[model samples]
Target: MSRHHDVVVIGGGQAGLAAGYHLRRLGLDFVILDARTTPGGAWQHTWGSLRLFSPAAYSSLPGRLMPPQEGQTYPDGAHVIEYLTEYEQRYGLPIVRPVAVDAVRRDGDRLRVESGSGEWRARAVISATGTWWRPFMPAVPGRAEFEGTQLHTVEYRRPADLAGQRVIVVGGGNSGAQIAADLAHETDLTWVTQRPPRFLADDIDGRALFDHATARRRALDEGRTDTGGVASLGDIVAVPPVREARDAGLLKAQPMFARMTATGVEWADGTTAEADTIVWCTGFRPALSHLAPLGLRGPRGHIPTAGTRALGEPRLHLLGYGDWTGPASATLIGVGRPARDAARAIAELLAEA
Candidate 1:
C-alpha cells in the first residue's frame, strides 16, 4: 500500500530535521526522507578535515544543543555526524533513510513524493535538500582540454592526497581559504579567487554572523529604514589553522586565471603557470531537479520563496538554501529559524484542511 503523510519533508539534513522538529511539536504526521543511509545527511559525505566555523554551542538545531566531547570546542564533521545521529534518536523524528526522492508531482489536492523505495502522498512538502549534490565549477576557457587531476571541494577528502602537488584552489569563499590553508602545510598551493578574499575579524565567528543576520532580518521585517552593514559568511574566519597559515605567509591570494591550458593556466597578463591539480571550491546550486516538473523555478533556477514558503505554491516550502529562503538559512545556526517558520506555515495549512 502507498504510504501517506500529512506533510513530507525531503532531505533529512539540518534543514529537514529542523522542520521535523517543529512538525513533531505541532502534532503533525510527517516523515523525513533521507537520501543517505545514515542520519548525518550531507555531513556524512563531507571531508574529514572540515569543521564548523562556529563552536558546538552556536551550531545547533531547534530543540537540542550539540554536546561536544570532553575538552572539545569547535566540532569537526565527525562530531556533527554523531550529534545528528543522536538528535534523531532523542526526538525520535519520523525519518526514512536511503530513500532518494525522484520527483514531486501534483496529485489533485496533495503532492506525491515519488522516491526509489516508494511513494508518499502529503498535503504539504518541504524541500530541505542542501546543495551538496550540485557542486558547481565555472567554465574556464579550454578547461575541457586540460589533462590534470581536477576535483571540486565535494570530492576532496584528505590533505595528504594533495601533498607535494602544485594545486590551484579556486573561489574566495571560506571553503577555498580553509582548503588552501590545509594544503599549504605539505604542498605548494596557489589561492585563486575572482576577487580578493576578505578575512573577517578575529573575534567574529559564525555566532556573531548569525546574530547580525537576526538583527538585519528583524529590521527588514519591521520596515526600519536604518539598516546596518552585514557581513557574508563567505568571508574567511581567522581560525587557528587559517591564522597559522597566514602567519607563515601562506595566505597570499592570486587573481583568477584567464583560461586553462593543456598543462596549466594562462594569466590575464599572458603569464603561464603549471599546476598538478585544480581544486575548485566554487559553491553549489539548489538540488531542485525533482521540483523542476512543477514549473516553479525562475530563470536562475530558484523558486521564489516568501520566508520559506513558495511564492505561488503555498503548499511548498524551501529551507536552508540561502538568504532568499530565509536569513542565513544555509548555515548550521541559520537553518533553525526558517525551519520553525515553515512548520508554522504548514501547520496553519493543515488546520485549514
Candidate 2:
C-alpha cells in the first residue's frame, strides 16, 4: 500500500521528533516513520548507567524542556527516554512505528520511501536515523581469533554482569572513559586507547560544549578562522562519575594493543594482558543504508549537505548525524537549530513546487 504527504520523516528518534515540532508549526502535511516499536529513539538503547552531558534544562528539544530528575545532577538514559516519550505526546507528532524503511528511491517528482509496512511518497524526506545502530569496531588483526567475548557499546547495559572478570575497555572517547569508570571497581579493568584520552575541565558541561560549537559555527559562517571548538577543549567531559573515576585513578589508559590473541591481546612492546571480555566503545557511522538507493552518499558513506539539506538532492534532509550535518547536531539541544532550518528550507521548496 502507499500513502502520500508533503514530507515523510524516517526515524522517529530525537532528530525526527525535532523536525516534527517545526513541521507542525508550519502546518505541513507530514508523517514520521519510526522503526522502533516505542518512542525515545536511540536513547532506548543506551547503557543503563549512561548519563547526559548536561542538566535537564540544558538538554531539550525545540518546544519543551526536559524535566529535571530530583537530586540528580546529570540525568541517566532512562530519564532521557522519559523526556523523549513525553515530548512526543505533548506535541502530538504524527508517528507510525515499527515500520522499517528499506529504501528511498526517486519517484518522478517525489521521493518514494519503501518500507515493510507500506510505502510513502513525499515531496521531501527527512532522514534522522541516528548513529547508535551502526557501532564501529576497528580492524585489528586477529580480532576474530580472540577466544574471549567481545561486545560494543550497543550491547552493553551494565557492568554488574561482568563483575569479578578481567576486562579491557577500548576507545578514547567519552563512552570509553565512562564505561571504563562504570566497570572500574566491578572488574579487573584495563582501559586502552589509540592515544591518550583528553578530559575537559570538571566545570565544563554540555551547555559549554554546545556554546563552543555554536561559536565555532558562527565564526566559520562569518568567514573567520575556524576555532577548533569542542576539540580544542577536550574529547571526554569530566562528568561526575568520570571525574570521580579520574580522581580515583581508575581511568588510566593503556596504548592500543598490537593485535588480538587467543588468550587476550598483545602490544607492540611485547606487553600482553589476559581478559575474559573486551568492550569496544569506538563509536558509530550514520545509519543511512535506507538512503543507499538514492545514490547521493559520498565516499565516506555520508550524504553531503548544506546545513541539513542534501547538496545533490535538496529534496532530502539529513539531520543529527554529527558536525557535518550541523554543529553538535547529534545532541538534544543542538538538533533543534538544524531541524528548524531543514523544515524551513523544505517549506520554501515545497511552496515553490
Candidate 3:
C-alpha cells in the first residue's frame, strides 16, 4: 500500500523537526523524512569538537529552552546533538529516518516522493534539507596529484587526527578558522583565503556573531546592494570564532591558491607553501538535484523563494534557503520564521484542497 500524508517534511534537521513540532500542534497529519540514520543533520556530520559560538539562549528550539550552561560561550556539537535528540523524543514527532529521498515530483493534485524504501504521497512538501547538504570545493589544477590526505571540513573531527602534520586550510570562513585554530596547537597550520577576512570582535556586546547576524539582518536588507552574486551580507562576514583565531595568531590571512602540487599549494601571487594535509572550508551548495520539475530555482541553481511568498506554487514550499533579506539568511536562527511560514502555508493549502 502507498503511504499517504497531509504533509511530508524532508530533512530531519533542526528546521524540519521544528516545523514538525508546529505542524503537529496545529492538529495536522505530517511525516518527516530524513536522510541520516538519526536526527541532527549537519550536527551529526560536524567535527566532534565543534561548539556553537552563540550562547545557549539563542540555540534553543521554538518552544523549549536549551539546557542552562554557565559559560557565555556556545555549546559543542555533542551538546547540540543531545538537545536535538531530546527535542525529537519530547515532541514525539513522527520521523522516518535513514530514508534518503531521491526525488520529489508533482502528480495532479498530490506530490510523490521517491526514496530507496518506496514512494510516498503527500498533499504538500516542505524542503527543510538546509543549505549545507552539499559541500563546496573549488576546482584547482593538479588537485588530484596531491598525494597527501585531503578532506573537506565536513569530514574533519578532532585535532589529534592532524597532530604533527603540516595542515593547510582553504577559505577564510568560520569553519576554516575554527579548524585551523583547533589544529594549530598540535600541528603546523597555514590558512589560505581568497581575501583577508573582515574581522569582528571576539564577543560583541556579550553576543556571538550568529546572534548579531540575526539582529542585523534587517539592517542588511535595507542597505543591501546587488553584487551580482547569490551571497548576502551574512554569507561574507566572519563569525566570532574566526575573529578570536585571528586575534590569537592561530590563523594568518593569505590569498587563494592558484594551483596544487604534491609538495604544496601555489598562491595567486606567485608563492608556494608546503602542507601535509589540506582541509577545504570553502562553503556549501544546496543539494537540489533530487528536486525535479520545479522551475523555482534561480540562475545560480538555488531555490528562489522570497520572504515567505510561496513562489506562486500552491502546494510547493522551500525552507532553510538563504539570502531572503540580509546576511544571516542561511543560519538556523534565520530559518525559524521561514519554517513557521512554510508550515502555515502547507496547512492552508491542504485546508483549501
Candidate 4:
C-alpha cells in the first residue's frame, strides 16, 4: 500500500526544508523525503573549512534567520549544518530519512514516487534534489590512464587529506578557487582553468550576487532585456580566504591542459607538469535521474520549467537546481522565494483539481 500525500518533497536539504516550511504554514498534507541518515543535507558532506560567501545574517531560509556564529563573520560548513538541523526541529517539518527515491512516474491523476523504504502517491511532487550527487568531471583525454589520484569536489573533505602532495585543482568555479586556496599552503598546488579565472571584486559577496539576481528577475518579469545575473559579476567570489591567497601570490591559475599523461598533464604546446593528485572542482548537474521516468527532460537533460512548475508535466515541480527553477534558488537565502512559490502553486493546483 502506497502512502498518499497532498504534496511530496523529494529532498531534505535547504530546498526541501524551505518547501516544507511553506507547505506546513499553508496547512497542506505533505512529507519531505531525505536520503541521508541524519539532517544537514549536503552541508554535512562539504569540507570542514568551507565558508559561506555571505554572513549568516544574509544567508537564511524563510521564517527562521540563521543565528550569527560567534567570532565568525562568514559561517563554515559545520555552522550551516547546525543551523539546518535546528531549523528542521524548530518547524517540526515532517520528513523521513534514509529513503532513497528511485524514480517518479505518472499515475492516474497523480505521481508515484518509488523509494527504498516504500512508495508514495502525491498530487504534486517537488524535486528539490540539488546537484551534489551528480558531480561533473570533464573527460580530459588519457584521464583513465593517469596513475595519479583524481577526486571531484564531492569527495573532498579537508586540506590535510592531500597534505604534502603535488596537487592540481581543476575548473575555475568557486569550488576550484576555494579548494585550491585551502590546499595552497599545505601542498605544492597548481590551479588550472579552461580560461583564466575571473574573481569578483573583494567587496562583492553573496548579498550583492542575490541583489543582482533580483534585478535580473524583475527585468525578465517586466519583459525587458535580461541582465545576466550573477554571471555578469564574475565566476568566483573573493571570500576572505580566497582573497588573502590571491593577495599573497598563492592563488595563480594556469590554462587547462590539452590532455592527461600517464603521470601528469600536457599543455597544447606540449609543456608537461607532474602531480600526485588532481582535484576536479568541475561542478555538477541536477540530480534528476529519479525523474527520468517522467520523460520531461530536454536535450540538455533539464526539465523545462515555467517558474518552478515543469512545463511538460504540471504535476511536477523542480526546486533549488539553479536560477532556471528560480533566481538564486541554489543559495540558502535565495531558495525561500521559489519554495514559497512552488507551495502556493501546488495549493492552487490542488484547489482547481
Candidate 5:
C-alpha cells in the first residue's frame, strides 16, 4: 500500500528502535521499515561464538536495559537477539518486515520510499540503516589467483566451517580478534593487521569505553576538547576467549601482507604463508543505497547533518553511523541520544508545517 506517514524510521535495529521510542513519546505517526524477517539486525549474521565485549548493563538501547541472563556475565548474539525482539514487542512499535527499501526520492515536499511491496511517503525519514551490509575488502594484487576459500566477516557463521583448514584472519578489530581466537581452536590460524591493535588493560571493558565516549561527547557539546588517553572501544577488551588466546600466543597478528599468492598470501618480508581459507574481518560501509535516488549523499555515502538532522536535505536524518552521524553512534548505548534528539527535531519541524 502506498501511504504517507509523519515519520518513517528505517532499519528497525537498535538505532531505529530508539527513534521509535521517542516518536511514540511525541505521539507521532511513524512506521519502522526493517529488512530483516526477525529482529536483531546484523547481530543475527555475526559468528555464532560472538559475545558482547560489555556486560548487559552497558549494552542497552534507549528505553530498556538488557536484563542479564542468569549467571551470564557477557551476553552472546542470541541473547541480544532475544532482547531486541522483546524490545520491539514491548513497545508495540509498528515494523514492516522484510520490506527492503530500494530507493528514496522526493515527491513535492515529501520523500517517497520505494520498496518491493509498495512505497511510503514521509515528511521526515530517519535512516538508521547501519554499516553492516556493505563489506569492504582492500584491493590486494593476485586475489583472483588465490585458489582458496575467502569470505568477508559478514559471511562467517561459525568455526566448524573451516575446521582442520589453515585460515588467515584479516583485520585487527574486535571481530577479527574474536573470530581468530575461535578459529584457532578449530584450524591452523594466523592473524594479520595493518598495524598492531591496541588492547585496553585487563580490568577495563565496555563500561569504561561507554563512559569515555560519554565524557568525550560532553566535552564537545560544551565547546571544549577531550584530550587523549581516553580508551576507545576500538581497543580490544580482554574478553575471556581473547584473553586465553593472548595467553596462548594465538592473538598476535603480523603486518598486512603485500599480496595474495596462488595458494595463500605473501608478506612484505618475502615470507609466504599458505592457507586453505582467508577470512576478511574488514568493516562495512553505511547501508544507504536506498537513498541513492535522492542524490544528496556526499563523501563515503553519508550526508552532512546537525545533530542527526540532514543539513541540505532538511527532511532527512541519518543515525547510528560510526562517529560521523553521532558520537560513538554505531554502538547500542550511543544511538539513544541521537535518536531521541532526531525524533524531537522531526516532531518540531513537522508541527511547524
Candidate 6:
C-alpha cells in the first residue's frame, strides 16, 4: 500500500520546517519531504563564509530561540545550519531527505507526490520550496564565443578560487558586493551594474534595520495598524560590503553592457574590459514547476498568491512569496510572518474539513 499523510510539505528548508512545526502542534498527521541529505536548504549549498544579514533573534524557527551570539552582527551559514539541525531534533519532525520529488499532481480529491523511491498521498500540500530554486542568467550577445571561464554567483565558492585572475562581477546586489570585495584582495576585479545602487546603513548600535522591517511586516499581517508599503533596502539598509571595493578602485562601476564579443564585454558607454572570468550575480526565479495546474503564476512565471490566500486553491498555500504587504519579502526574517500566517490558515482549513 502507498504511504498516506494528512498534509505533505515539499522542501525541508526553513519555510517547510516552519510549516511542519506548526502542523505537529495542531496534532495533524504530516511529513516533510526534502531533496537534500540534510535540512537548511540552500544555506548548505552557499559559500562557506555566508552569514545572515539579520541578527540571531529574528532567525529562529517557531518554538526554539536561536542561540545567543552577543557580539556578532550576523550569524554565519554554519551557525544557521546548526540551529536548524537542532530545531529538527527538538521537535522530532519527520523529514525524509535525499528524496527528489519527480512530480506533484492532484488526483481526484487527493494530491500525489512521487519521488524516486516511492509515492505519498495527502489531503493538502504546502509547496515550501523557496524562490532560489533557479538562478537567473541574462543572455549577452556573443557570450557563447567568449574565451574565458564563466559562472553564476551561486556557483562561486571563495576568493582564493579567483586568485591572479581578472574577474568581472556583474550585478549590484548584496551577493555581488560581498563577493567583489572579497575577491579584490587576490584578483583584478571590476564591478558592473546597470542601475545605480541604493545603499543601506550598517547595523546601528546592535539593532539591524532588517529587524524593524520584519517586525513591521508581522504587525501589518496581523492587522494591527496600517504600516504602509513594503520596505526596500534602498531606504534604510546600509550599502553592502561592495562599497568598500569601489572606494579602493579595485572595483570600477560600469553600465549594463551593450553587447559581448569573443574578446571582452562592451559597456553601453562605448568602453570595453577584458576578463578571464565573469560572475553573474543577477538573481533568482521562484521554483513552482510542481504547481502546474494551479494556474497561479503571473506574466513572469511567479505565483500570484495574494495575502496568504494560497491563490484560491483548497488547502494549498505558500509561506514566503515575497513582500505581500511589507517592504522586504525574500529574507529569512521577512518570511516568518507569512509562515506563521500560513500555519494558522492551514490549521483553520483542517478544522473546517
Q: Write the per-residue lDDT of candidate 6 for residues 135-229, one digit (tens) a residue.
A: 88898887898899988877999988989998888887767776777788888888888776555655441135555665676787698975544
What TM-scores do the predictions have?
0.97, 0.99, 0.88, 0.98, 0.97, 0.88
Regions of candidate 6 where Cα sits further than 4 Å from its true position: 69-71, 204-252, 293-295, 324-329
The whole-model lDDT of each prediction reads: 0.88, 0.94, 0.73, 0.94, 0.87, 0.73
Task: Report the error of model 2 at residue 211, Å.
Answer: 0.3
Q: Give the per-residue lDDT of model 3 (tens digit) for 227-305.
A: 3332233332244555566567777767888899998888778789888999999888777776756556666776556
Q: Residues 67-163, candidate 2, lDDT per residue (tens digit)?
A: 9998898999899999999999999999999989999999999999999898999999999999999999999999999999999999998988899
Q: Can you tell me which runs of candidate 2 are displaced by over 4 Å?
A: none
User: What is candidate 4's lDDT per residue for 1-353, written digit by digit as tens?
Assistant: 79999999999999999999999999999999999999999998998779999999899999999999999889999999999999999999999998999999999999999987999999999999999989999888999989989999989989999999999999898999999999999999999998889999989999989988998889989999988868877999999999999999998999999999888999999999999999999989999999989889896778999999999999899999998899899999999999999999999999999
| Residue pairs whose backbone atoms clash in candidate 3 | 234-327
lDDT for model 6 comes to 0.73
lDDT of 3: 0.73
Clashing pairs in 6: 200-237, 200-238, 200-239, 201-237, 201-238, 230-326, 230-327, 231-327, 323-329
Q: TM-score ranking from best to worst? A: 2, 4, 1, 5, 6, 3
Give the per-residue lDDT of model 5 (tens digit) for 166-274: 9999998888888988998889998999889877787788778878877877887798976443443456787888889989887888899999988999987899999
Alpha carbon deviation, residue 258, candidate 6 (Å):
1.3
